[model samples]
Target: MRIVWFRQDLRCQDHPALSEAAQKGEVLPLYILNDTHPGKWVMGEASRLWLHHSLKALSDSFNGHLAFYKGDPLNILPQLIKETGAEGVYWNRCYEPWAITRDKKLKEHLKKEGLDVQSFNGSLLWEPWETTKGDGTPYKVFTPFYKTSCLKGEPPRTPLPKPTLTCAPLPPSSLTLNAIDLLPKKPWGKEVFSGWEPGEAGAEKRWEIFLKEGLKGYKVGRDLPAQAHVSRLSPHLHFGEISPHQLWADVSKIEEGHDTNHFLSELGWREFSHNLLYHFPSLPEKNLQEKFDRFQWKKDPKLLKAWQTGHTGYPFVDAGMRELYATGYMHNRMRMVVGSFLVKNLLLHWHEGEAWFWDCLFDADLANNSASWQWIGGCGADAAPYFRIFNPITQGEKFDPQGDYTRKYVPELAKLSDKYLFRPWEAPEEILEQAGIVLGKDYPLPIVDLKASREEALAAFERIKEK
Candidate 1:
């Protein structure tokens, strides 16, 4: 018998471990829940909620035969082995530092017990170690790394087909889905997030939707938050509800063009993040460029709270934060805008923004979240130039030209014209009164002066560069 262990790779299709297990023998489908396993990398409220729904969907796929156990995998896997008399265990790999450490130790212990243990690349398009510079070192910048990876390849191997399974009966200690309690005691997620369907089927639905609606205009429209031109697939990809290989294959069906290549490069960024994390386990905590350590960052609780609650009074920044609060997701362009606002305009550390997003984002991926925040804060490898500060007012006016995205999330500013919509503080009192708005009462005054803050941020950044 074979035990098919599920971790972040939750779905069944094109899953190397599950597919291989089915081909070999009777499969004991398993998901072990140990919040202690990943240490401080434990699931946040949003991820916890998604996991609950995902497990239910996975169990339903197994026809209610999946074993859901709550314990350390060391203790639980042994018990499961004894229960089923399984000769081998198989699973897809996880790339997080904690997951890497845990998987290695677990694999060693299991193999010592004389049971066959196997793991496969069920998550990434290429193994993180596979892509490297010609000198056999990791690439620190993105463009050369992206171009080099493209040139080095036989394109991604075709995704494996779903394998037929011979199921084993569940063990007596198997826990019910409710016992996991990935859902919150509070009702915030269920109430706010009804738009997503969390399962393999749901992943397929989103894949189809993106292809039909988003493929043609993604190059131009992806940056426009008001348009439905981007795929909301990050959470599913994070949960392993969908595979990059599958997404790649489908997009490849499109006639090769700028739009298709742009979308593929975004996927490459996901790959690049894992590449960064694998090589530098300190990714979530330490800045990649050590010079950033000297960068002056403030610890004003008011600024942090203002940014988190979406009341910074910058329309685009606030809209992104509010959207994250109201619906657990933010548009990518807005993510960069808000990230720059917190780190640059507010002079708060990038870690503060990173931590907030870690808690609030439904698709809060460790590698992408940390790497992207550092990139925007101008402290990471392949980071933006320090001089290229994002002007949030102008960003809002440009991308969300008609104020549609702003009005949706920041409805208090709905009556303001596009001219003053993004920078409401600059509006005259007559216009404010006409629009039935009051600064700091109905909405908020800009928490920091844009021009003043920009100059301060630039000077502070220069000091760090000199150091």
Candidate 2:
């Protein structure tokens, strides 16, 4: 018998692992929820909730033969192999540093046990090392990275199909969704649970909807936090509920010329993230260049609290934070804007913001979240320059002209005019009173002046270059 060990690849559709397992022998589909690396890096509460639904959905697809375990997979898989007499193991690839290490150890252990082990690329459309610069080094900046990756010949024209036979019809196994402690016991999960429906079917439905209606205007409308123009498939893609190939396939079919081409290149950005993670294993944690280590950062607890609680008094930043808290997602543009406000405006450590997102976002991907945080902090590959501080008020006006997104999330300031939405501190005292907002009580005033903060950040950044 062969074992199909499911990691992030939660779906059966386009899963090369299942096909390979079936080819080997009766597949014992498995998923191991190893918290052994406690603090090693686990999914947030929101992500755990999504995983529960996604796994339940995958099990539903199968006739309940899939097995799940809670502890170390290295320990559990060996026991399972001995019990089921499995001939081999097959699974998909993951580019996260921890995952790469885990897979390597598992493969080596399994190989020593005299069993066959195999893996395939499913999480990303292209491997990180594939589209390097001519010197064979990974692309550090995004524009050139995107260009090189996009210019490379397209992904395989045809995607792999679901395995014809997941396993030679096996007797029911003793695994259910509740057996894992992934679900929350209390009432707080209600909001997050309500926001998502996990599994391949839901992912496909989301992609289909995006491809049909959202892709055409994705370039123009993706920046607007108020609309659903951007594909809301991050969690699915992150969890491997849907393969990157499946997403790429749908976009590639769009006959709308430049729009279609642009969409495909955006998909390449996701690949670019994975590639960077693979090559720079310390990525997301370490700066791509080392001089950033000397950059001065504040450990201001009050500022950190304000930033985390959406009380920064920067309307757009607060709105994005609240939106992230309410829904387990945020628009890509706001991610940069809010990240800049925290790192650049507040002068807090990038890791602090990365940790907050780690706790909040349902789609808290290791590579994307870490890379994005570092990028915004002006400390990592293709990062926004340190001098380029986001004027939160102007960014809000430009990206959310109508301030609809902010109003929806920050209802206390909803009645405030669009002009005052971005900068409540600058509003007249009467206007603030009429809006029932005290600079510090009803809503906090800007914690720091933007102009002063920008200059402080830029001057401090100069030290790094001087060294």
Candidate 3:
């Protein structure tokens, strides 16, 4: 019997390791929750909640034969092997630094014991090592990386079909899904995850809906937070409920155009982030551009709390944070806006934003979270310029012109007109009263003057530039 280990790749369809194992002989599906090795990068509360439902769906697909264990894989895998007499182990690759180190050691140890141990690339379209520059160094910029290397290099392998499975009986020692304790004890857990369907079936259905309704006007409409142009597939992709290969192959069949090309490029960006993390293992902790190490960052607990609780006084920024808290998700445009406000306007460290997102976002990914925060901080490869601060007022007016997205999250400002929705402090007292709103009480006054904060952030950037 072969042991097919499930990690981020949760779905049975198009699973390389699972298909290969199933083709060989009876397969024992195993999931090990290794919290200790990941340290600070362990799966956050939102991710755990999603996993709880996802695991239940997967186990149901296997007819309750799936096995679950919680501990270091080094100890648990060997014990399972000895007990089940499994001759081989197979798993898909994970790109995290800790996971890479752990898997390498496990594979070598397993091989030494005369067992077949193999890992397949089931996540990324192009492996990080496969898409390097002619000099064999990783690409630091994304445009050339995608256009010159990735697009021009060997295409992603065709997705595998699910193999017919002959299952081994569940090991008696396998723990129940609830025993893993992935769900929170609080009432908010159910409320936050109410609309999300976290499973393989849900993922497939979402993709189908996106293909029909969302993909047509995706390029321009994707920028509008209120619009339903986006696929909302990040959490599914993060959990590997759907494969990039499947998405790419299916989309490639469509008539090539701006919408299709732009959508594909977004996937390319996901690849770019992973490439950065794989090449620079310290990506989550350090600045890629060394000069940013000397950048002065502020520490203000009150301001941080205001930002976190969606009381930041910048409606656009507050709206994004509120959406994230309410739904465990935020629009991509809003992610940049809120990120810029924290790292630039507030002069807080990017790590603060990264940590908050790690805890709050359902789709939070280590590589993307780290890289995107660094981009906002103007400290990573091909990062946004430090001087380019996103004006919350203009951003809101531009993207959410009708106030649909802002009002949905920051509903206290619902009665306010579009003219003052993004900047209520500038509204006349009569106008505020007409809307049944008081600036400081009903919504909030701008916490910091945008002009002053922009200048301060620019001056701070200059200090590091001079150094």
Q: Give per-model CA RMSD.
A: 1.1, 2.1, 0.8
The regions of model 2 sitting more than 4 angstroms off are 166-175
Clashes of each: 0, 1, 0
Candidate 1 global TM-score: 0.98
Expressed as tens digits, the lDDT of each residue in 128-240 for candidate 3 is 99989999999989999999877888888888887899899989889999887788666656788766888899899999999999999999999999999999999999999
lDDT of 2 by residue, 93-161 (tens): 877777778889999999998998999877777666677888988887878887665565455436788
Please give the distance, in angstroms, between residue 404's alpha carbon in candidate 1 and its true position after superposition. 0.4
lDDT of 1 by residue, 135-223 (tens): 77888898887888754665887988878898899888888999877788787786666789888899899989989888789999999
- Ranking according to lDDT, highest score first: 3, 1, 2
TM-score versus the correct structure, for each prediction: 0.98, 0.95, 0.99
lDDT of 1 at 26: 95
Taken over the whole model, the C-alpha lDDT of each candidate is 0.89, 0.81, 0.92
